[model samples]
Target: MRVTPQPVRRQVEERLREAIITSRFMPGEHLSDRMLGDVFGVSRGVIREAVRLLEAEGLIKVVPNRGPFVAFLSAAEATQVYEVRAVLEALAGQGFAERASTEEIAELREVFEELAATRPGTDRMVLLNLKRRFYGVMLRGCRNAYVARMLDQLLNRNSQLRATTLSDPKRLPQTIAEIRRIVEAIERRDPGAAWAACREHVHQAAQVALRILNQQARDEAAQGLEVALD
Candidate 1:
């Protein structure tokens, strides 16, 4: 009854979390424990444990008698998330602007370079990982454990939306430009400017994501209508 390699459960949890956040496992899709166990090369027990982790993160839900399904974002939930992120990210920017050292600025620049080099149309999951690295520079620069903890959940969800937005060729330039402006404000040690820039960035991105999510819902609804008509 041993789950081979033991640590495979943790690996499976990470993989599933990535898949869910990147939209690879779309909302409302029920995850079959047996199929997932096979996919991860682990036991059903391991898959259950992995799902439990995601459920706790609010990225998945386990319904009684219905198994586990990927979590769907309500419009209200999405708006709240962006609102909270704006305040928290502004605080992070302020903290970073006030005390970010030259070394930290250079580190952030390096991450920005990495982000720029990443070509468009890359796998969403891979782009998310890179985006996390870019965000890591800002979070570390802020140097506040509480802010970091508050942002963890929001950041995970943001990365998913960011990836989807950036996937569109039309949005890529604006995304990069907005991020660059924030970086410039931070480098100048202008906390007010940094906060303003960061807030605008988050707000614009949120609008784009909301549009994308709404469009997806419409597409799904249309498909369901077609099925019904058939």
Candidate 2:
């Protein structure tokens, strides 16, 4: 059986999405359709489609007379994202613990091991991709379509902040430990433990990420003040 090729439109969209998530495009920076088309070697129409998709996903925003720009997230806004994601992911964890087959659990463990092995110096995109792979297994095995969909959306928004969050030397080890607890809980087939671990991991990440975001915000504000006064 021949596998169907992925659509070019989706391909362009995914590339653009990854670029934004990895901070190749800084937050609040203008996005020119012609520039993106040239960069991606795609047509303006394809770039527009990709931009529209990102805009719908909340990763990009289109303003009247301003075209498109990367969406900027404040720490307070990111907290809302983390809060919603934590609850949904905890539910997914509980479902996975109760419902995943042995094979699925093994697959999840394999992904977890790979994620655990990633060094602190790993490329941000590579680390985030591995994390997404781990969650892809868990979300599928959980067998809850709605929860999976909701959590995936939130994760997309969270990825930019998370990549920045991981740049802090203190976060990587703690992140790995929190994930270890999640894996162990799932292995024990304890829904409560799985939920607890998942929740704790998400909240811990939120705290670390928020600290980074707040500092960046303050720094930007100070720079803006200095520029205005000059």
Candidate 3:
């Protein structure tokens, strides 16, 4: 477990953010202040302050009459995220190819191998952690602080919405192939190829994810129409 350093409130805030991202708290789930206070061993005031921080981050939704609930995005909102991510990650990939040292390139290759070895039935959290590690290497090796900062914001929200896409067994092989192209490009220090590969990877993931979200929306609409006819 990673220990968060801070005043009580920041620690609690990170705790809540991780929970929300991991689906431990879950989308649209009511967050009871009392329950959080008991669980975190903090006072209600501390919970409120922490929740307020996440509300500003767009992970928590606070309504006029209702208390805080985990925020769930519409498909349109998710589309914007993926579009932004493609450009940001592409830049990071190009930068890493141009600037990363030999060791950094090798480290990325090793991480890619681990990811490729993962079977379809592998644990969800494990895959997420590995993917995070892979991106961490790319960001630091890229040595661009500005791009890293922008990607961090999108990644926080994107992870929550990517659960369905990442878990699709049908996409696993394609994902590995896409990421392998990125690793190979970076290893060869081909900046343009790395950029294109990264952009294409995000494009493919967006397609799979958006398709699922749209289908779910259609299913819900059809269900509501049935109730109306009743």
Q: Residue 30 of model 3: what lDDT?
A: 90
In lDDT terms, how accurate is model 2?
0.89
- Minimal lDDT window, size 10, model 1: 122-131
Model 2 stretches astray by more than 4 angstroms: none
State each model's CA lDDT, in order. 0.81, 0.89, 0.88
After superposition of all CA atoms, the RMSD between model 1 and the true structure is 4.0
Query: What is the Å distance of residue 62 in model 1 from its true position?
Result: 1.1
TM-score of each prediction: 0.85, 0.93, 0.93
What lDDT tens digits, residue by residue, belong to model 3 across residues 1-230? 99766998888988988988888988889998998988899999999999998888778899778899998877898899899999999999999999999999999999999999998877778778788889999999999999998897778786865665666788877888999999999988999999999999999999998888899899999999999999
lDDT of 2 by residue, 1-230 (tens): 99998898999999998888778898999999888988899889989998998999999989989899999888888989999989999999999999999999999999888877877788877778788888999999999999999998889887888886665567888888888898899999999999999999999999988988889989989999999999
Best model per lDDT: 2
lDDT, candidate 1, 1-102, per-residue tens:
875674777888889988777777877899989778777788899899989987887888899998999887766678889999999988888888887788
CA displacement after TM-score superposition, residue 209 of candidate 1 (Å): 0.8
> Candidate 1: lDDT of 112?
73
Backbone clash pairs for candidate 2 read: none
> Where is the poorest 10-residue window by lDDT in model 3?
158-167
Taking every candidate in turn, the Cα RMSD to the unseen true structure, in Å, is 4.0, 1.6, 2.4
